[model samples]
Target: MELRCKVFLRYCTCFAVIGALLVWPAPVHSAVVVIGARPYLERVAKRVVEILEGRYISGNSLPIADYVAPIQLTDKGLSITGNVSFHSAFLAKIDSIEFDAQKFSEIFLNTEVTVQGALKWHGIGVVLDFAANLEEYNGTGTLYVTYNQFDFPLKVTKPFNSTEPTGSLQFMSIDNSNKIVTVGYPNNKYVQLISRAIMTNFDFRDYMIASFRNWNFQNLLKAVIDEVPFPEVCYNC
Candidate 1:
């Protein structure tokens, strides 16, 4: 009877310990924002700039250095600038060929971009670069893509299309407070390049417009998201 009582007591103690363990609250980890995120986003932004440089200014395009200046993070997204220069060799080529009854050679393209929207994960269905409504985006920018280093700032409106190749119809936002980012693209958009130079017979408008089309903002946003180490649960995101 004594042995049986001791065994029964041990079983009771084990049950009590197990019950306590089950009822214990799990530890919570707070979401990290602005402080730990900015530098990472900046690095991503620089990489994006490099990719754009490769697409627009490399190889047979231009031998000059494509400069992507520093970026500024905003409430909805971020803003960035780049210096696109045409080297003397490119200029000489342009001078050699007569495009529109003019000697077209040395040029500088200074562009400003403002990207706004949010990043959302729509479960496991096609996780990369999902599309939100066009109305949800506020992505837009100005183009100083011109000749002889002329600063012709053209307002770029939304609804970017491959046909028009002037304005873009994409919206993206970066919310560090909520620890979330998003991108929205229109199925079809007329990216209007409203410029006085176009009316003044700027023969390079088409080339400038084409270059604008090559700047893929979506890739940039993707790079930024990929760089950050978000928690698996993403309770805050």
Candidate 2:
């Protein structure tokens, strides 16, 4: 009887352990590390550039708000005050784009873009509180701007309660010289003066950076990459 009771107790303990093993939830494998991620990132960058170029060509160009700046300067006892306004501005075309993948989460982009718009400048010569309209210039033209080697850093975040990861592309660290803006206008003293004044007062680089910062390229990239079956390794399992 004693032997039978001991055998029965051991069987019950085994059944309890088996039941616990069967009922407990399995560990969730939530982390994955991408292998050879550079090529994939390069592809994603190309696709994003293509999409942006296509969109710009298809009449979905980015619209710029009307910009107005007040210009004031004094040289050789000559006071000049003016107001410059740029209107109907649009980032009309993307001529070319080049991508360099520096790392799995960082990319550098070089692009040439064209901005078409109209500008008006009204200047007054102020002498001893007496102001008179000296020059009023109005013109329409295109600005060819080149951005060289601008950094796009990828940021990934996972919510505390969510398993899916979210990503974003951030624009960062563009050299002022790299943001080159050139326009062709008739070579005249008045035009030259206006151009110099406008260029001095208006920051084209900041405007371009602001426009790019507003765009979310990660969504476009994810749309293409999600369909691809890239090799990955398990992480934090």
Candidate 3:
């Protein structure tokens, strides 16, 4: 009878162990991001640029609330005479500048990549003293659009903000299979200045541009990027 009791207790212990194993959660294994991280990132950047270009189609106008004159003119009367005007005036749209994906430079893994494009502000200008019209501005003859930073919400296991590259790939994990990617405005001063300068120099040179300085180009770019669908990339099957 004692031997039977011992066997029964051993069976009960085995059942208990099996039951615990069944109830416990399995260990989480990190996901592997396929290679081709750089190409994927560049594609994402190009899509963002396309969205921005589309957002400001020719004829669509936006308000210039804080339009400031780049040069200090005390007594000279300034006026904007275009499809768009200034100082709470309308900002007339021009032709979309083509984004050159070939020149996408300073690529930092999946962190950032800069685009080269030209902004031609034709028929858009300020009339000084209601006399001389200044109607053109160019940055390196081509605007340098840098996709300042990117984030991976669906692909990354954890929230990450570091720009530094990691591992043999030399870039952050970019799941080619993932469908979504996040892009943010650049924090770089040169980029900010150039963006603002473009607006001030040709788009809104006559009005108090400083008053409308809150109109952030970065936010505009981010909004534009958000509207476009994330580009898809496939590699290694």
Candidate 2: regions farther than 4 A off: 1-33, 73-80, 103-150, 155-165, 184-187, 197-199, 202-208, 229-231
* Model number with the top TM-score: 2
Against the true structure, what is each candidate's TM-score? 0.24, 0.54, 0.29
Give the runs in model 1 whose Cα sits over 4 Å from its true position.
1-35, 54-56, 60-211, 217-224, 227-237
- Candidate 3 stretches greater than 4 Å from native: 1-38, 53-62, 66-86, 107-237
RMSDs, each prediction?
23.0, 12.5, 16.8
What TM-score number comes out for model 1? 0.24
lDDT by residue for model 3 over 74-140, one digit each (tens)?
Answer: 1235332222212223333332333334433322235332222222222222111111223322212
Inter-residue clash pairs, candidate 3:
66-209, 66-212, 67-207, 67-208, 67-209, 68-208, 68-209
* Every candidate's lDDT: 0.29, 0.46, 0.33
Q: Clash number for every model?
A: 16, 0, 7
Query: Could you arrange the candidates by TM-score from highest to lowest?
Result: 2, 3, 1
Best candidate, lDDT-wise? 2
Error of 1 at 94 (Å): 16
In angstroms, how far off is 103's CA in candidate 1?
Answer: 38
